[model samples]
Target chain A: MKLKCPTCGREYDEPVQRCECGEPVEFKLFEGEPYIAKTVWERFYDFWPVEPAMELSLGEGDTPLVKSRIGRELGVRLYLKNETANPTWSFKDRGTFLAVSYAVKAGYGAVGTVSTGNMAASVAAYAARAGLKAKILVSESASDEKLKAVGVYGADVIRVKGDYGRLYFESLKLGEKLGVYFINSDNPFRVEGYKGIAFEIAEEITPDYVLIPTSSGGLFRGIAKGFIELRESGLIEEIPTLVAVQAEGCSPICRAFSEGKERIGRFENPKTIAKAIANPYPPSGNAVLKLLREFGWKCLSVSDEEILEAQRKLAGEGIFVQPASATGVAALEKLVEGGGIEEGAKIVSILTGSGLKTLATAGQGNARECPLEGLENCVSF
Target chain B: MKLKCPTCGREYDEPVQRCECGEPVEFKLFEGEPYIAKTVWERFYDFWPVEPAMELSLGEGDTPLVKSRIGRELGVRLYLKNETANPTWSFKDRGTFLAVSYAVKAGYGAVGTVSTGNMAASVAAYAARAGLKAKILVSESASDEKLKAVGVYGADVIRVKGDYGRLYFESLKLGEKLGVYFINSDNPFRVEGYKGIAFEIAEEITPDYVLIPTSSGGLFRGIAKGFIELRESGLIEEIPTLVAVQAEGCSPICRAFSEGKERIGRFENPKTIAKAIANPYPPSGNAVLKLLREFGWKCLSVSDEEILEAQRKLAGEGIFVQPASATGVAALEKLVEGGGIEEGAKIVSILTGSGLKTLATAGQGNARECPLEGLENCVSF
Candidate 1:
């Protein structure tokens, strides 16, 4: 495998440094269809690098893409790629599983990352499964629900007592200095695993457009790469336009896309129910901005009210997802109004984390308690 | 498939009334394996099914057996068969799928059920899938979280303005009068659907003991049948003793097993955190009692605190489950007292509902808010 500059196609042995062509290099494949040792590896087998020395896994792929009937009442063929079906109940497992396995194979004893919710839990679980020491850094104020989820995976969790905006770069440097493999949320291998989402969507049904709830841009970039690989493999004749959805509170990509700017300054004063993806300065902001420009794709942001409405619509359909995930659905409403989605377009919105992990900020669902002695009060004896 | 009386071996075409011998004819196969075609339909072919069918299904069976590391710390090999992976986020989908399929095949236009949670949602979702109307009779005081989950499937949820205990029977009589197929919680075919759980366990591993959070005896009976069928088919040589775990508040089977009673008497004033299975008068109470005696099985109960502990343990492991589902793990702790889990003995505990669906009663898992412009408070800049 080799790293290739997306801008210049110049190959490099490593992506750790700027490319010889002066552009940041990205991870590359060996130029062949990926193969799985067993079909148990699932639909993602064709999308990932399929390394022979890879201490690969079979537990986290092929999530269910359920058609959203209730969302249709709002006028769209909405489908929720139930990514919570992954091993760790979050799509982060896909990236973390691949990244951790790679890290382990690369002779790394310790792996670390900076995350908010799903990523922390995902890396922790996959790291534990791979028998590697795992470390996670998060803002101390991260939701107790997410922190508890992360800690439960037995990861060494450190809560930084400051804003997490700059912690990402700090962790990267610290990991490198400590000889630790930092599977940054946007690490090439981790993002490579994200491609499986696209492969799965294609295998299940040809989606007209994919609504990705973007935070760090790794998931969106991965989905785009997955489609490119598909077209490269002749699996699909056309690529679906990927729409990256974000909270209006912290949407650098949306701002850049709207202003027709090639780069996004760090967003200030981020706010929303979607604390999961409230990264004011997304790591893959440039990469995703490039994707939108390269594909002529559009970006959309949903208000807090709209996100809440989307969450309610999803729960009404029996899918309780957190705010960040609901952003994709919320953006669909915008797309419909803007005439961005055709009447017949098949749309899929990714639901990122399980709702159980974030009830405090999203508002708790109704709770009714009647003592057992009072059972007859609601029935006939 | 033929229904035969367990006592006389007489067959009955319909499960209505009693057998020709005048005993309540349990739906036993008079001859061969009843039929898989009547249960999972074709989706049965996707996942590993014991005896999958050709036709007839409302999309039941094939729940994801998530590889969650929940409770790996108790030196326990924990595997959550996330029955919540079902469409309705509960294991009840297995049974309701079968019962409702038969109901539709029997030409019923509407389906009715009496459940405080899972079964209600399962029947409603499957009914929607099958294009049949569904009427769910639940306690007015049933957790609003559960009611919303069930009601969202487009089922007509009737919160009887009276006693919940009576609603169970009331729905049945009302369904009969309206020609609605009452998919009783423990209906024989519903039990048939539950057999899939055992099939899944066998697919995963031969558990030394399968811990079931028992309610109306259907889940318990189905698991036992799976093991028994596997043994009969020469697929396995020995059957593991099934363990029934019940909430201390409503443990009629546990009470009977402890008392060595040939039959179960009604349990009164049942109360516990595990509301899904806290049944004071389970319809299959006697049948479960008989199985316990015939198989030398055992029953155990856990307090609300124990269930809460189990729930927290599982959440840490990344599998958020309801208190009812956690009861089995709670009982397992007691069984593992003094650190004794029968060396090399595999124990499989069924987690029946998504903790996200019942967040009202769950530990809440620590969800803190970013506090509007309070981002700086939670993050490091």
Candidate 2:
């Protein structure tokens, strides 16, 4: 049970989120073929570092890969890895489910997370299901609407008024003293859980390109590792080119990659409608930069306007995703405009969360009103 | 293809939503073992009266049956049939997917539905996916927030000012004249699509009791018929006790059943927070009443307070469903208190929709604020 740092090559047998060198650490690699079963946990048991408690599952993963009708117009065959169909209506469920299992297996009676968004709700739901107390610590400025879902799952949500950003790192130390496992965004087990996304996609189709919506960069690193593992195991002939999609308003990793910087600098005064992915200083940003450089992967950022248009296009295709989730689709349009992708090439875009989470924007001034009498007049073909 | 009247025993050669005798019409029964395949349409081809166009699917059905923790306290093993995992975040996707497939295959250029809720969003999404025009007719009083998801799917959401109740029947006739198939809530194909719920559940577990959240009687009738078909095909030895659960504020069918009425009499001025199921005059009420009598089934209603409590209870179990969906759990509690269910009996409750749809109530005055300094002081065990 040794945790290894990818940067300094430091190994520790005790539980630690980051290495002494201030870089994120992950479990040491273990080699085994994926176990075949129904649920993701069962099917990928050999790939997971910890044995997941079989009973602790809300039936997460195995999301549908819906074919996109917009592909014909974009000059490529496209499929949406619809992560919105997960239990918590987001891809975070994949990570949270696994993290909670580890916490329960380690005999932790309480767990905590520092998110007022998708991760908070996911951890709360999983923690409640696993019969563990959940302590959700969010910034003082967190929206009441966003925290509602998290509270509904019986998690004790606390709003920290000052230096809330620093609390992300401090919570781990405080949680240790309180015997509560803090599964922040880029926890090792959570990153391991995200690999299931890559595993399931490969089972469905061997895409030439996989566009992922990048936030804290944990998802990007996990997916990249998943493909690498598959190739190493002879399960896949070649790993698809993984593209990191980000919002133009706040994209530290993409900016660093485009600038040929070895490390990501903190983004300043972030302003994006895709608030879900608006991470100013992502913890795993350096790791993502390394992956992008190592794999020759492209990192692109789209404006809020493009993200909105992509959202509408997805809705037109009968897939409603949040603006942040639409970043991948928006990136595809940019690639098409620049002729970056070949015609008829199989491409997959990850739709990270459901639009239902951000319905206020979708409903804003879009509905048309009609009269009662002679309603047939309004029913024009 | 021939359509048969369940009440009058009359048959028609052409497709019709309901019989001239004022009762719903269904495709004549077909007999064969289910064709084992990936999607529900392919697997259940033998049972379908009309051949569904294979490509018309938004990954509907195949929902997970999650085991409940609260059941242990009630002395029964409970499983929540999590239909919220459907693409549209509701069970209505099943019916809409099937109905939209029929419309596309029947060469209809346009489709219409009379709804402002789950069915509306489901039809709009599926119609958009199938590349058909969707004319959604909603009542004037539908909340803008509720209709937002429906409109996002690029549907023609027209608000009708006149009598919405009469408009339901009139839309069918007008839809025919306008070359559009009007798929109101109780459409035969939609009901047939719901049969997949029963089929899937039966494949997983044969419960001693199955609780359903009844609205327009479509879902209730669908599950009943699904079990009947399974028995007819020798798939299951016996059918579970089918219980219809409804909100007490608007429980016309339940009221009628408790009073031993042959036909359901509409309840006026219905008031319930569960707007999704608050149908004052459900079109399929009579059919549901008939099933209740024929099968010696029970129909029960829970107060709004009880429904709210059930919603909270479900959230505590890591499953957050809408108020209407929680009626099944509310009914289960009532049954337990009344000594209706036997100890250790296997019971399955249907969680019809997700709580994300009604976040306003869940978010109402539940969030708490804390100070920024010394946040560790708040991290008490």
Candidate 3:
């Protein structure tokens, strides 16, 4: 397998995130039918570019594609790819698990990632499970409470006090020199692993639409590539209409697409409650934008209020997802209202992470206090 | 299936927790091969006393049984039933899903549960999903922040200021009057739901021992009965030695078992970091005691310190479980030290809930601060 630059078309035999032209690269598609088997790994063994260190898996994939009640309400048969059930409570585990596996196989002593949220926790956990030293570099602004989950995995968490923007690139250079594999957002192997999500969803249902919550855009691109490869392999007849959903506050990809720009520019001062998907200048924005144009698929952004309402609606369906994960649901509602999606269309919204991690956003509707003496008065149907 | 009293041999067709003899009753063993099908519900349909209202399911069962790395360090082949993967992030989802199903099928417009922890959240989520109003009666001492997940599910959370002990019984009686089926901790249907755990474990690997973190002891009795019914059905020849693990600070069942007492007494002034399992007066204590004696199974206690250490150890293995869930591991170490467990014995510990729910207990182990300029100094093997 080879890594090929999307823009420059430069090819590298070795794993590389970006080409010399400063364009993000991806694996040259693995052309083969999925291995017919029980488990996700066995079924998709030949599809991955590198052989996964399967022994290190925390039962990450094959999350339930539950049918949503909201689908009926929206006049579309909706399914939620419940990715919160992943080991580290996020979709990042699918990527991190594969990245850590490659790091272990290459005899790398340590792995590092620049993240304070889901990715950091994912890298820390999978690395710990694989018995590899993990250095999780986070911005100084990250709260101690938020870092607790990452630190608990016994990873070497370093609070880098400066512009983390520079550190993302610097760490990649320094990590290679220090025998540490830096799997920052949009890493080649990480993107390869996310293909499993697309494969798994296709196996369950041939969705007419797949709405993905876009941040760094790795998830969107990976899913798109997954379907592309499946169609190429004669495993799937047609690819789903992939929709990139982003927060309006920080939607560089959506803005670039809307303006018919070839490349994306950074947004200033992103202020969204959906912090998880608030990437001002996503590393894979250009790649995601390219797919959006090539397929004539939509790149939509929803307001923070819309995301919160979507989160609430999901909670009503017995799923408590983070505000960022609800971006897809919010986008679906918009598409329904605008008649962008036809009635009876099979739609799926990816719920990326669990709300347990963000309980503060669950709202402050305190329990009604009922005095012991007159508690009977409060006990009404 | 009939509800049979364990003590007086009285039987009833209607759903009931206790017999007229004031002893906890259980579903009489259903004699039939498990429904051979894809999902756990279909596979174990015959085992369930009541036909489940399948429409209310939120993909609760079929949790992964992961092999533990700590098992190797402890010289035992150990498996962890990762119940944290449940819909609501706890094993309580298994029982709550069943209890809520029963409530919905019984034509109850509303359901109530007395809990401030995992059960409250599980019941609230399932009830909402089942389209039934949920009345969660939590103690006045319960924090609002902790109830956010439950509240988000649209449950009517009522903080009752009174003796919680008396309220538990009163709510059951009052709930029936108000057409609200109260599913307090040891509800018979809830116990029946827990049988799935044992059935699942047996389906994967037959072990020499199965450790469960005991709170109200419903989980313990349910698992015990599961194995008993399986054996009666000729599904297995040997039943694993069931171990009831509890926090040392509040272990009424452990105290009684250690003293060879027939009944358990209330443990006063209970204190433990594993507050989720620190039940001073577990309602199903006598029932659990009877099973322990009947099967010659073990009942043990571990200190809060041990639980924390075990929790930390699990984190190292990439499983972030709550302190209470770590009780099984803590007890295993003690049993291994005391030469109670034989070498090469296959053991399974139930990691009941996710550590994400109790992030406070994960402690404040802050990361090492690194200045941006000399970050290369921090990049060491």
- Residue range A13-107, candidate 1, lDDT tens digits: 65456777788887875663233332224434555664422333425655666766744555567778887655556788778877877787788
lDDT of 2: 0.86
Per-residue lDDT, model 3, residue A153, is 93
User: Can you give the DockQ of every candidate in the order shown?
Assistant: 0.10, 0.36, 0.39
Judged by DockQ cut-offs, is candidate 1 incorrect, acceptable, medium or high? incorrect
Order of the predicted models by DockQ, top scorer first: 3, 2, 1
Residue range A108-179, candidate 3, lDDT tens digits: 989999898899989988888888899999898998988998999999999998987788788999998889
Best by DockQ: 3
Fnat measured on candidate 3: 0.66
> How would you encode candidate 1's per-residue C-alpha lDDT over B233-336 as one tens digit per residue?
77777888778999988899899889878778888887787877888888888888888888877788899988988877665554667889988788876766
TM-score of each: 0.73, 0.89, 0.89
Off by over 4 Å in 3: A1-38, B1-37
Q: What is the TM-score of chain A in candidate 1?
A: 0.84
Pairwise DockQ winner, candidates 2 and 3: 3
TM-score of chain B of each: 0.79, 0.88, 0.89
Question: Which prediction has more favorable TM-score, 1 or 3?
Answer: 3
